[model samples]
Structures are given as C-alpha cells and as structure tokens.
Target: MLEKEYDVIIIGAGVAGCVAALKLVANGKRVLLVEKLKKIGSHNSRKLDVTESQGIADITAELNLPFNGKFNRSIWYSPNANFELDSRVYDYYVLRGSDVDSFESIVSNRIKSFGGTVLTNAEITNYNFENEYVKSVVINYNNRHQVVNCKYLFFADGHHSKSLEIFGIKERPGPTFIGYGEICVNSELKAGVTHVFFDSKLAPGGYFYLGKADNGEVLSSIVINKALQGNISIKTYYQNFIAANANILKLLGKYKVKNSFVGMGKTGIISRRSLRNMALLGDAGRTMDPIFGYGVRQAIISGYMAAVSAIDCLNNKKRDLDEYEDKLNKSVFQGRETENQKFRNFIDHLNNEELDYAFKSIETIGLSTSLDDFFDNPFNNIGMLLNVTLKKPKLLTTVIIKFFLA
Candidate 1:
C-alpha cells in the first residue's frame, strides 16, 4: 500500500505543472506538485528574458487567476526588414526582462496559497501500476524513497521526460544541438522592444534574440539548430556571432558577462498524449511551435486542459481521457497543427538565398509588421501565402504534398 494518496500528482513545477496544481485545487481536488530541481522555474529559458504569447492572457482570463505576467512589445529583424508588432491585435504586455525570476516565485506561491502541495528536490523515480494504469508515483525525496498514490498523473517534466518512455510513447525528433547564452551590451536597445535576428549565418537553422529589462539589463542569446555537420562547434558559433555581427557588437559596446548554456531537444510533436490515466503536458508533450520553440503559452494551455481531463476522469464525468488530446488539437492548435508542420517543412527546404529572397519579398509586398499583427489573422491573409507560392511554385508544391502525404 502507498504511504499517502491524493486526487492527482503533477510532476515538474514549471508553468504547466503549477497551473495544473492551482486549477485542480480550485476544482476541489487534492494536488501534489513535484519538482526535481531545488527551485521552481529556474530553468535555462528563464534567463533569456523571453516574452509570453497572447495565449497566456487568454488562460489568465479563463481561469480568473490573480497571476498577471508582464510581456513586452517585440520587433522582428529579418535579413531584409525590421518592424515592430502591432499591439492592437490583442491585450498583450511585454515582460520586463528582470521579472523572469520573480514570475516563477509568484506562481509557486500562488500554488501554495491555493492549498496545493509543492515539493522541491523531489523526483519521481518510478511508478506503481494497476492493470496498466498508473496508481501511484515512486518519488525520491531528500534521500528517502516515498510512495505517493494518486488517481491521475501529469508529466510536465519538459522535453527530456523519462515518463514519456515509461508510458510507452515514442520519442519526438528535432535538432541535434541547441546553444543559448546571455551577453551584456553597453548600449541600450528599445526599452520595450524585443529584437529577433533570423539570418542563417548567425544561427543557421535557429535564430538569435535580445531583450532589455526595464532596469536596462539586456539578455542576448543564440540558438543553433541541427549542429551535427557544422564546421565550428556550438560555442564557436556563439562566440563568432558576437564577434562578427557588427550590429549586435555595436549594441554590446560595453557589457558584463552573466551566464550561458547549451542543450538539445526533440522538435517534433508527440504522437501519443496519454497512456491510461497518465497525460503529458508542455515540452514533454512536444507542443512547441517547432518553427520557433515558443511554448510558454502552449504549456499553460496544456496544463489547464490536462487538469480538466484529470478531474473529469476521476469524477466519472468523462468516459476516458482521450478527449484531452482531441480538445487540445481543436482548441489550442485550432486544427492548424498540420499547417504549422507544413510551414516547418517549407522552411527546411529553403537555402540561405531563398530565405533572404522570401524575407525581401515580405518587405517589398508591405507584409512586414509586428509578429502579432501578421499572426493575428495569418490564414485569413491568403493573398500572402498565394504570393509566396507564386514566387516559389516548386517549393510550395513540395511543402503541400509533404503535408498531404503525412
């Protein structure tokens, strides 16, 4: 028998895990949140001064939670043009880069305030199963092994989750190497504008980004995609990019070094979302946009959805948890996961010259604007897609065929 039991057990106290805990408690369920790290939300992504997408705002309104995250106005600097996002798209705010650490702290405290249990430095080493359904989690806490039973389990442990394997789900595939690091600049960028650089030379398949906090601290980073055949190492790319990119160097006239890191992740979306009573959320589920690795909003959405599914399953309100995947595909992805996949495939087929040409065409056609402005009604702008197809008929056809075949 297990030492303790709860209505639900959520692993990984990141954004998704915390949201699941808080929401589950609000629905009158006992929740235990487990984090393997000593601290919550202290991951490498936090150090990058990233912005929260508009989906986060929707989650806040839906949940009526007191938590408010500050997001920043952003600018996309392509090889051919530079433009800022139009704020009129939705009620989005820019994240003051300095608030990364505090945001995690606030979420952690909110979970506790709502009577949700959170355990740091606690890891789920294994699980106890009954008839193929996970009945409880075997956790290692503070050097002691503990058995904690629960009706449902949430695996939000991120991109490299072992629980996914335990659940018999095949792993997703992606880039071979991802390198990210912070650089301080003497000069200040736009106060609220986050800048993204998309030149292949700088990051090849990935991109580079920079954002400044209200306090004037800037965090610059480079993510290298598919670094297997690269001549230079990931670190070399980072160092060379800083040294070679004049604009970036000029921006960093004088600055102090803070921290840097490199990691790998699977870029493909997960095929299996759940096995019996166990469900995957966030990176563990591979819900990122793939094109850009933007998952904060997706993470929040997955957590909220998973919590609802868990509650419904435990209460017999739903026959099974299969609805969780269906709901996510319909609601969060808006039935456009295939389109996004096609976009990724199309991008993969392009060379540097083609990429530059595409960006140039976007600027020439007056389509260049804030990221939000374009994505606000992306598909509605069929003219843009048609225009691109007209420019590169062969590539567009291949992308479409691949999507259809898949």
Candidate 2:
C-alpha cells in the first residue's frame, strides 16, 4: 500500500499513464500509477504498437535506456497484389514488455525514480463522482479495499476500459473488429520489417498484421469485422491468414505458438475528453489512427498534453479543466474522428478486388506520403487519395464526394 492521498492518481500504468505520471512527478507533484496486473509488463495489453512518431527513441534517450525502435521497410499487401515503402528516415515501432530495451519497461521502471508510486495488481472498482467531477477511487488489492483521494484523476485505462460503462458515457462507435491471433517464432521475417495484408476474406473491414521483433519473435494477427460478410468462424480466418502467408511461417525452425489471444479492437472515439476533475487519456478516448491503428504516439502525446493541462488547472485552484478537451481537440488525433470515420466506412465497403486494384494503382503512382506528415491528419494527402479513387469513380461513394468536394 502506498500513500492515502496524492496530487494526481492515474488509473492505468501503460504508456500513457507512465508518461503522465513521469511529467507530473517531475513537476514535484505526488503521483500514483495504478495497474490491474500483478506486474508492469505482465499484461497482453502492454504489447506492440506501430507508432507514427519516435516515442521510443525520444523516451529511451531521455531515460538513457538502450532500446531503439528503428525500422527500415514497410510492406502493404492486398489479396492479389502488394506494394512496398522504403524509408531510410524512420518508421517507428515500440515493443512493450519486461525486456530491458522495451519502451514500457524503460518508462515503467523509472516511475519510483521520479518520486511516483506504482501499485500493481490493483483494481479501481469504484469512483466517487461529485457534481460530475471525480473526487476519489476505491481500490481493490490483496483482498482488501481502500479509498484514496486525489486532486486530479486520469483515465488511461485502455481500449476495453469499463470506466465509460461505469460512468454511463456514450462513445462515438466506429468499426469494431475481432482481433484474433498469436505470437510465434520468427525465422523468416527480417528484423525492422513489417507486413500489412488487406483481404476482405481474412480481415474484412480491417487488415492482418505481422511484424518481427529484434528478439526473433513474430506477432501475427488479424482484425476482422465482428459482423463478417459470411458466417465463417474467426478461427478459420486466422488459419487462412497463416496459410496464405507462407513467408510468415517458420521455414527452417519448428513452428510454435508462443502465446495466443482474442480481443475486441475498438476504433471508437470518445467525444467528451474530460470532466472538471478527470481527464481521459489513451485508448479510453480512442486517441489513435482508426485506419492504420497507430496508437502509441497518440497515447504518449495525449499523456503529455493532459499533464500540461493538469498543471494549468491545479495552479488555478482546481478550476474546471475545460482547456484539457480543447488541448486534446487541437493536438494528438486533432479532432479528426469524423474524417477517419468516413475513411473507415469508405474502406469497409471496398471488396477484395477493389483493394487489390487500389494497391496496384498505388504501385503505379507512388507513395510520396511521409509517415510523420501523414500522421498529422491523413486528410492532407487527398491528392493521393483522389488519384486512386478517380481510377474507379464508382468506388467514390456519394458520401465521400459530399464530404470532400463539398
């Protein structure tokens, strides 16, 4: 058990929570980071995230951690065709685990160094809300209950967070996908290379992803539409994805499943970002790229932005932190949910043939889009988008025309 009260209490210890706590504690505030897991890196949620920024490098350099998240090549494959993006600049990725070089490990291990406390195996079962402002939380750990009060609260509770359900907050839902997959031994996929497969049959509205870590472990997963076109089993889709990608399988080494999991991938964005005393961070607010699933960068940015907003609010005697929402709106995902939702819907209706055609067309044209530039709201790359869509004008639904041209 840590202190009874603090200046700030964070509900999660993932990337966002750790970053927020680091900043707050660095500013000389008493901070507590609570994680429901038994240890910092023991949860499935604290895994790999293909980020848009150099969050890994920045944090690692600041902390003097040896981890480097540099990647060289990225491959995008349709069912029938594929395209490649060769970047000598930087295509970032962050691995989260107990490894010394992992980003989560690097940040999480330094919580106490910054004068912050991390309580693992803790569940915040209840929260006391007064006049729509959060006052405190009921923590369950070691079969005992304790109440802790704090001046400000952060909900970095992740994608499957029940905080919204408990608070009865309605989330603006997007395409929900059933992400079913496994971690396997890597013998083929070169380090610093990633593959994204677009197949309506395998992933439906979403896509299948396979990337190898520097430690020779490969993560192969597919996000398929929950309401699939055919009444096929998700298991079949997973197996088919593996079968189709023979290169992903261990050719020389014996194939083995390191771990397996099935979970829901929420593409929804919560419109209401904060209350007077509580702020939502990370996937709880769906601060991510809906199409490409780039979350870690957004999560880190939101955490830092929220910490800045918290400092301003606390200095003003805990006044309403309406500026938190404004900050979130203008930064991170940058209030682009409407545009992302439209793009998601547009891609959802696209069949396998259409996707293959789009890939071929991109191969014909070229990807002049930079990772960082496109990360700052993908709508700015409308010229490339229009070039592909104009090839098959019917693929451009009326909704797209009205949204863009209008």
In order, candidate lDDTs are 0.67, 0.72
Clashes of each: 9, 0
Error of 2 at 164 (Å): 2.7
lDDT of 2 at 73: 82
* Candidate 2 structure quality by residue, lDDT tens digits, 1-406: 5687888999888778878888787788889899998878665543455555444356545544323355768888897888887654565556666555666667876778887888899998888877777778899988899999988888998888876776567888776667766667745656777888888766787787777666666667777767563787777788887787765564314556777766565678665878777878887877766665543777777788788788887777865667878877776555578888877776777778777777776665556666445545557877776776687776556435544642
For candidate 1, the TM-score is 0.82
- If scored against the real structure, what TM-score would every candidate get? 0.82, 0.82
- What ranges in model 1 sit over 4 Å off? 1-3, 49-52, 62-74, 80-100, 183-187, 227-231, 315-319, 367-406
Best by TM-score: 2
* Stretches of model 2 off by over 4 angstroms after superposition: 45-47, 54-68, 87-89, 97-102, 129-132, 165-168, 229-233, 247-256, 367-406
Candidate 2 lDDT for residue 104: 64
Cα RMSD to native, each candidate? 4.3, 4.1
Evaluated at residue 227, the lDDT of candidate 2 is: 56
